[model samples]
Target: MVSIRSVHGSAQLLLDVTGGVTDIVEKMHRTIAREVNPLNRLRDMTGETPVAKQGHTYRIIQSTTSLLKQGLHRSLDGLSAQEEWELSPQSLKITAALNGVCGDHLEASGNPLAISMHLRNSRGEKLQPGSTSLSTMIPDASPRIAVLVHGLCLSHEYWKGHNEGNLGTELQSAHGFTPLYLNYNTGRHISRNGRELSQQLQRLIETWPVEVEELTLIGHSMGGLVIRSACWYAGELDLPWTSRLKNAVYLGSPHHGAALAKAGHLLTSVMRQFRYASPFALVRHTSAGIKDLRHGNLLDDDWAGVDQDDFHPDYRKPVPLHEGTRHYFIAAAIGKQVWDLPSTMLGDLLVRLDSARGQHSDDLKKLSICAEDCRVFEKLNHLDLLDNKVVHEQILGWLA
Candidate 1:
């Protein structure tokens, strides 16, 4: 259920968006007003006066909008003090997408819309790691555990869609491995989420009702990158959960980088070079998570001091697969056959073939995955990797 807190957060976000659009529109109007006059345009072109001074009319409009927004904000605050309300499934989906786009900003601004990292059951109930109630939450807990992580703009409930829920049931029935789902804000940096996940997993293992003999991690798309990041952090911190980890599976994961994210970065960078286009670029407010996807960044050092808006080459440090654990990679293509050009160039429509396979032009950055350990399914797009029965069967076969 959506709470009163979320309602207020949504209202706040709407006001912020309205304010931003008003500012942009004002700038655009000013630019147009200046350019319409030849003398002003000439001055702008010569850099003598790049921006025209704000007119009295523009100031009055901005002031009026600001006042109106402030009034709305106060009203929303009052509404927020009311009893909690239930959030519908549709609202939850929208909130997840919003988080993926600007989750870092939401968190920084203390917006209640920001999703905190947590483990959840299929019913979407939060499961506190190390809590005594964990056994009650998962009564059929097993010695072998498989934790499923979803991709960007998604919640733990994603696994329960399109018959994919059977993956968990079958895993338990076939292998005596209990399944758990990880729910988190996908807009945060992968390294940050990874660090938190490492700690969470440790607490889970320490508090598990049964003695854990094996742990398997399965992730799709960005979730795979998060899992890899968590593994790296876990090793660095010497977390005990790392000892129980036996297998890590990556399905349609961009180990090197995603193609679409790089394209977006390039597009925005190019736009920032021109004055009129710069406003549009500013409108693209991508999160740190989206920026990290440009080159599969999984460390703080990769982006700490760099300006994301400026064009920069890939500078991510290499993160290797966890030692003492078997790794598997699954890739998909939209084409009907592996030999098809589309299959080779545009695997899964979002991730490229080589990237999903952890292939890199530079040897130092390549993942040392075995040829037999990687599988590519044709005629499958990115999201299909999550729901397809073939993908699930392949996962089971590898675990078996």
Candidate 2:
């Protein structure tokens, strides 16, 4: 049976999309008619085109909007929150994808699907991890916490693959470390999410049923940047949780910056140079979180007042790893041979080898991971890091 909640949610999304499209079209039409269309401008100057006709177009748009609201409201009139069904994996995936693309906007606009930072159980239910709620949530939770942060456009559920096992589960069975999955909005600025994560970790550790002896963070891609950002904030605030942090592992993380986002920004810039293509360039108006990844931004000041569509030189401050924490990095490449430049350049498809390894031309921006602590795997893409057997073994070895 189709869910009323889904129906209502779909209708609301449709209305929002329609409204945005309508506004864009109206603006484009006005611009083209006034400036691009010489014939219309000539007609206006010659008094051949009636101003009233243009006014009619706006009136029709207003009337259509009113009708759309009425129809959507009527369709959702009998729907109640109780009628909502549990979110399927597919539905959750779609929601996560949307959040990754426009999460900052959705959050600013107060969209219902905008995900908040939460610790989730294996079944994907949120756990408070507070003293009062920890027992009811996870009765046998271990004091050694291993937190897993997923990449952009993904949810905690993504950690559980189809056939191959994820690192978190494997580590749980091999070692007695308890795994906590984080579900958060990936569209917000990395620093914003980082600060929130820092605070949340403090709360989580302090409220643990037992003393947190060790806290290890395993982050993939952008999740690594968030972890790093959180670490900086944790130091600034002098949180007690910082003392408990033991190991920090980054898998396929673009510690320097991803080339793909830079290339996309170039394309958007080219499109914005012309009048007609300018509106199309709006397609690149992704969330601030994604834009930050372009230069591996780990601080709020990195993006202060920067235009979303324009390319800016790297303005990030150097964020080194915590001195007390052990850092491990793993990068993947699709090339069969490790020496292949093509595959090496396309590190894990989304990150570059040098970037993932935290190499930088700017001396200040270079990270402190030792050469021995880093590993690179050939014949693997970015997502493969989650389930690859060899990668799993390497992680187990590192944790051990």
Highest-lDDT candidate: 1
**Candidate 1, superposed: residue stretches over 4 Å from native:** 1-3, 33-86, 163-165, 282-284
For residue 241, what is the lDDT in candidate 2?
87
Q: Model 2: residues >4 Å from true position, as ranges?
A: 1-5, 35-85
Q: How do the residues 1-400 of candidate 2 rate in per-residue lDDT, one tens digit apiece?
A: 6667656655666666767676666656656777755677667665566433664676687678768767765666466344645678888788888888888977885445677788876657788856586767777778888999998999888788655886777878999888889989999999999999999999999888778899999999999999999999998888878899999999999988887887888888898887777776764777888888889999988888777678678878888888899999999888988679867667778998989999899888988778889999999898888878898899889889
lDDT of 1: 0.84
Candidate 2 local distance difference test against the native: 0.82
The 0-to-1 C-alpha lDDT of every candidate, in the order given, reads 0.84, 0.82
Error (Å) of candidate 2 at residue 11 is 2.6
State candidate 1's TM-score: 0.90
Query: TM-scores across all candidates?
Result: 0.90, 0.90
lDDT of 2 at 370: 89
